[model samples]
Target: MKTLQQSRAIIATAILGVIVSTYALYVEMAAESKPGYKALCDISEYASCSRVLTSEYSKGFGIIPKESALEVPNCIYGTLFYCFMIFLATFDHIGVNRLQLLLSLVSCASSVYLAYLLAFVLHDICLVCISTYFINGLLLWLVYNKNKQLVEKKK
Candidate 1:
């Protein structure tokens, strides 16, 4: 695929990522952290995003801490990750492609793990979280398709 088309798709996907992450962040802040604050995404007791988002797993410093060991909100990290993807897509460099690939892998793995956590560990599902996972899967597909086309063109 041409760089222009791929970049456009990436930009769109990143925008979607931002929207989803922001919604989750809002839920985390307004509903999860606060009592008696019902969030829009909180469909039911079994599908309570507030509950899952407020859990201990919702915050961490990731695999490696660059400067400090301060535990950060997962939604905050996700929002930043999506915004970084927007920056990467806008630049349209080889380095951006590599970074997107790395990001996609982590997104996919984490989504899978979260899904498993919901099914087995948590015993409840978050609709907002599932939507983000679906978005991540879409991003993975878009990146794979774009990279495959590039490889095909090179060969």
Candidate 2:
């Protein structure tokens, strides 16, 4: 059984993830409107918000443009995922274990992919992006730690 404090911590981390992700998405959308703000866009080389956003790489796997909807970046999907995690953490009355495991795997995978973007693809760190990564990493860690307890109990 998880302690109250541990449960609260997980919930807090999940909420943090949602907030950061949402903020990143907001910044990405806001950048599309102003040309001057394009300089802060994610991605390496061109580094221009407008350039990367307009670039083919910004598109989904292939044909889909990242900012096709509401002119918001695809990265917003990450934020949405975090928000789902927050929902699971705060009011998980069904399959709590399964939810935790799913969140742990997704958060871990997200952290790894985002790190790659920061270190290799982006080559530069935006404050909002960095904060999102930090929150994701923290949530992953907490989930992993909590999972360990479950494993121990089963042993």
Candidate 3:
């Protein structure tokens, strides 16, 4: 029964993550249609989405921005990362605690960084981005709680 509950929690988190990601992606794509934002192929510097996506902060080790390439919006990366959180939580629910712990930590850190970017750097907060951040926070909390419960059970 406890396992079932945990499984449901993980699944619910995943679904929420996917929903937030899709919405964020939609916003990113729509932003492209605006005059200031540019498609990834365009590299000009007048408030271009392409500029942000291609920037050093976009991804690690020269990997292209998956979210931008998908043409949704750069913010969709948070959505996708949250989706990964769900996957990790599910794996943890199925008895893989280490993966879950590592991923959740990553999610927590990413969420903080994203919030910082939205609030400080962008100086503009989109509804979808805010929603995704909230969801990520909730999922992180849940993952932490589950891990705590597991530790308690062991003791």
Candidate 4:
């Protein structure tokens, strides 16, 4: 069984994720309107959220799936991903031992890759994106520890 604190942490992180991703999506959409517009997230040259967002990789795997036919903001995917995490946390076990841990690992892995792209490939940092990545990493850590606690309790 997960602890109350663990559950609360998960819920809080999910809520934060939703807020961040929604703002990111808003920035993305707002860009389509104004030509020279920049989001408040665009803090500086090295850490320009808007520039990183407009990069080719921002479309995410949709680039390969849609074959560039569609360009969906990565924020949409992040929002949905966090929503799923919240749902799972609220519903309890996913009928598979350590499923939540597995999911977190996958999500964190994706975040790591994206962070790499932002840092090394794109040569720019996105404040909003970095914050989301941090949240996901924290969520993964919390959930992983909770999974360990569950295993220990069973023994």
Candidate 5:
């Protein structure tokens, strides 16, 4: 019963993450294609989604060089991560739950780093970015609860 509820929560959170990541990807692409493109999330100069999405950190989390082959857009990574979370949550096995917890931990750490960059480095507010971070944090909480439930069940 609890497991089912947790699975549903994780799936729902991942779905929301997918939506926000997809929107960010669209904004990134549109900004690249169109000159002076402004996203709906672009509220002002400091709170501009377009500005953050097109910055140096937008691709490969500013880690990979632009000339590198692995330098894909960060939104693509987020989309794939959320999709995988949804799929993993479908399995109720202990191994699957452990994997989910591990992935969520990594995601949360990445979110913290990205949040710092957004606040300090970029000095810009991205609604889409913030939404995805919230979604990721929710997923981490859900996955952690699910893992706890599984351990309690085994005891």
Candidate 6:
């Protein structure tokens, strides 16, 4: 894709990621505050977003200790990541593209770990979580394509 087209695609994907992440954050907070709160994404007992969001794995990617200061919700990380992606996409420089590609790769790796937890460990299907995973994968593809285009242009 052309640089302009690639940038637009990345921006659009990041916007979707932001929206989904924001909703996940809202669900996380609302469920924490209100007792018996059920999110719209909470479809069923086995496929409950509330259950997944409220789980131990939802914060700090389930890697950081809960007592640690850096143990924030994953949605917060998701929000910041998409925002950073948007910022990086706004700059069309090769270095900026490289950074974007690297970030996307990292995000995808995180998604893989989270997905494993969701399926085997958590044993629940969270729509919101799945959506973010899909978004992350899409962003990785878009950023990778953009980087490949950039490299080919230099040939």
lDDT digits (tens) for residues 52-85 of candidate 6: 9989999999989989988999999999999999
Identify the leading candidate in terms of TM-score: 5
lDDT of each: 0.77, 0.59, 0.57, 0.78, 0.94, 0.92
Ranking by TM-score: 5, 6, 4, 1, 2, 3
lDDT of 2 by residue, 37-154 (tens): 6444455543434443343333342246545654445456666666676666664343565676676777667566655765577554555555666777777777666666656656
Instruction: Give the Å error, residue 85, model 6.
Output: 0.4
Scored against the true structure, residue 19 in model 1 reaches a CA lDDT of 86
Clash pairs (backbone) in predicted model 3:
28-73, 29-72
- Candidate 2 wrongly placed segments (more than 4 Å): 38-72, 91-95, 151-155
Q: Per-residue lDDT tens digits of candidate 5, residues 61-134?
A: 99998899889989999999999999999998999999999999999899999999999999999999999889
Clashes of 6: 0
Q: What lDDT is obtained when candidate 1 is compared to the true structure?
A: 0.77
Better of 1 and 4 by TM-score: 4
Q: Which 10 successive residues of model 5 have the least lDDT summed?
A: 129-138
Question: Tens-digit lDDT track for model 1 on 1-155?
Answer: 67678878877987888888888878778865578888787778898888888776667623335345657777777788788877777654555677788898898899888788877888888988888888888888877777666566667
Which scores better on TM-score, 1 or 2?
1
lDDT of 2 at 122: 57
Off by over 4 Å in 4: 61-71, 94-97
Where does candidate 2 have its weakest 10-residue lDDT segment?
A: 53-62
Name the better of 1 and 5 by TM-score.
Answer: 5
lDDT of 3: 0.57
Clash list (residue pairs), candidate 1: none
